[model samples]
Target: MRQILLFAALAAVLALLLVSCGGTKDKPVPTEEDAPGKAAYHKISAEEAYEMMISQEIVVVDVRTREEYDGGHIENAVLVPNESIGSEMPETLPDKEATLLIYCRSGRRSKDAAQKLLALGYQSVYDFGGVIDWPYELVKEG
Candidate 1:
């Protein structure tokens, strides 16, 4: 009788655990790829990104507002506001596997934009904060 009670209790506990975990028999365990981390979305210095810009082929994305970008922006940086990263990627940038160097007016917008870009299937996205910290040349629109 004691052995029967022990078996029943163990079975009950096992059933509870399975039900608590969504009750799915074939569900795989979640991994970091299921949710990206900060390191995956690298936050490098402006100088680092600048060196890449000069030395290698990289796409620089500015996540600031149009007015902010129009004020002054790093040369060769394209405007793709954080709010504009919709379900579809910008037509100007269609390569999901491209190495993207992203920035904004400050660090906040760039971080948000980088995550969104990653979620949208951008494989390599780097958030280098704002151009305000960039100790380099800036281009003003006419």
Candidate 2:
């Protein structure tokens, strides 16, 4: 009887361990509803980005190469190439809690940069996809 009780207790402990260890591996997708100090990042549309740009003070980041940026980019957008970002926080982006609107030539780099920024403790990061999809006016470098 003593042996049986010990075995039952061990089995219950093992079951609890297994239950606690089981969890989803997938990352949570950030939504438009995500606010600063709440979520890591938010995926928004070009129109939504435009509204935020006009209505509030936001840091518009073009996460593309210098050459690409020189070709043309959204007005007031600063060049902060995705390749330039590393483990260290970017110098151009000083404030971690600032509202950042990130973009690239296409949607891929923007997503990657946004994730990196979030990992660096940025409180308010928004990925607005590619500049190719931007219908608004662009400023070309001289």
Candidate 3:
């Protein structure tokens, strides 16, 4: 009887788990930050980002400081410092539904800034890692 009860309990737990961990057919593919009270953002490669920039009307965001941005950045990239992002929507990023491609000097701050932008209700946000990984040419501010 003891062994039977143990098997029954194990089966019950397994059934519960299967029900709880159901398929996400209705929901979009979730990112690492996708969770309760958290936001979701896509992490793409620099090459992918470049393609998107040319193929579509997307916003390239440089989440680095003014000094860093002045040094060098992708052509047509807008400077939106990560430190400046707050609860309110930034004036520079007026369109919440516009596709945003965010990057930083070393990829860390870009991810952080992407999450914040999603939380701010931005529909499409992508982090293409750090500019250091970018093999393409970068234009310097005059």
Candidate 4:
């Protein structure tokens, strides 16, 4: 009886350990002041982006092809294709401390661009998904 009780206790302890070590929880959204080398971008909704656009002076970046951009894009959004981003900072975007709002056609490239910008030390980067999700008016190229 004593041996059986010891084995049961050991099994219970092992199960608890396994449960505790199973997986990690989702990380919280990073802020502008998050430590260097950490994720420095924030994922915001289109509504939130619109609110910010109305309330602040932000640099809206369209991380899509020029062809797609010419079709239609957010007003005042600059074209900086994800493929064009290199080791050096983009000339159009000179201020690393400025608030950057990024978007792509379907949210994939925007995320990639936002991460790259953050890695490049651009503080206050916000990924507001894609332009398809943007309900606001778009400006077409002349």
Candidate 5:
């Protein structure tokens, strides 16, 4: 009977330890974080993206390959390949607060990059469709 009681006490202590070390469940996930400083996902059209670019200091991100980017892209968009974006913040996008305008060959990769950026806690991510749909003049890297 004494041994059983001791085993029960040990089991209780172990359970308490597990609960303490399991981490908190209240913390928001990257994409769901919407507090003042936290990031949120926002979708915008190509025209709206252009307007924001002209009116604001937004960073245009081309989530395409170097070859794809050299072919043609927005005036000053930086290259951050979709495959490169993972758990870590991208090198080209240092400011998590900067308004990120994402684009790719078509609408598909842009959406993917946007989701990844959101998951990485990047605020104000705007996906502007594809370069093929962009009405503005595209500049090819010389």
Candidate 6:
């Protein structure tokens, strides 16, 4: 009976320690919590994304290969190849809280990248479709 009591006491102490370390409700929320593990994805128009780009400090990301990006892409889009987003985020985008605008040659890569970005803890991720659907002028990297 004494041993059981001691084990119960230890368990209670461990539970308290775990609760304390879990995190406080009053603490500042993590950026990743807002958009975690592909649970968040916003589909917006190219025009809307462009407008936001002009108005906000957003990161426009191209989730395609270097060759695909060199062919033609929206001006000022940082390359974060889709295959490179696991364990750690792409070097091009370190801020998990940044409003990320992602795209690719077609909608598929953009969709995949958007989900991966969310999984990597990006707070505000927007998938504005692909360059193929973009009506805006695209510039080729020479």
- List the lowest-lDDT window of 10 residues for candidate 4: 23-32
Candidate 1, residues 1-142: lDDT per residue as tens digits? 9999999999999999988876876678876765654236788999999899989889999888899899999888889888898888887678988889999977999999898888788888999998879899999898
Residue 21 deviation, candidate 1, in Å? 31
Q: Candidate 3 lDDT, tens digit per residue, 1-142?
A: 9999999999999878877876344466666566654446789999999999889999999999998998989999999999999999989999998899999999999999999999899988999999999999999888
What is the lDDT, from 0 to 100, of the residue 105 in candidate 5?
88
Indicate which candidate wins on TM-score: 4
What's the residue-level lDDT of 24 in candidate 6?
58
Task: Write model 5 residue lDDT over 1-142, tens digit each, in one string.
Answer: 9999999999999889878776466464545355677666677888999999999999999998999999989999999999999999988899988889999988899999999998888878989878888998999989
Residues 26-137 of candidate 2: C-alpha lDDT, one tens digit per residue: 4566566454356566899999999999999999999999999999999989889999899999999999878999999889999999999988888889999999999999
Q: What is the clash count for each candidate, in the order shown? A: 0, 0, 0, 0, 0, 0
Report the lDDT of model 6 for residue 138: 84
lDDT of 2 at 118: 86
TM-score each candidate.
0.72, 0.74, 0.74, 0.75, 0.73, 0.71
lDDT of 1 at 4: 100
Error of 6 at 41 (Å): 1.0
Instruction: TM-score for candidate 2, please give it.
Output: 0.74
Estimate, for each residue in 54-116, the C-alpha lDDT of model 6 and write its tens digit: 999999999989999999988999999998888787888989988999998878889899998
lDDT of each: 0.87, 0.90, 0.91, 0.91, 0.88, 0.87
Clashing pairs in 3: none
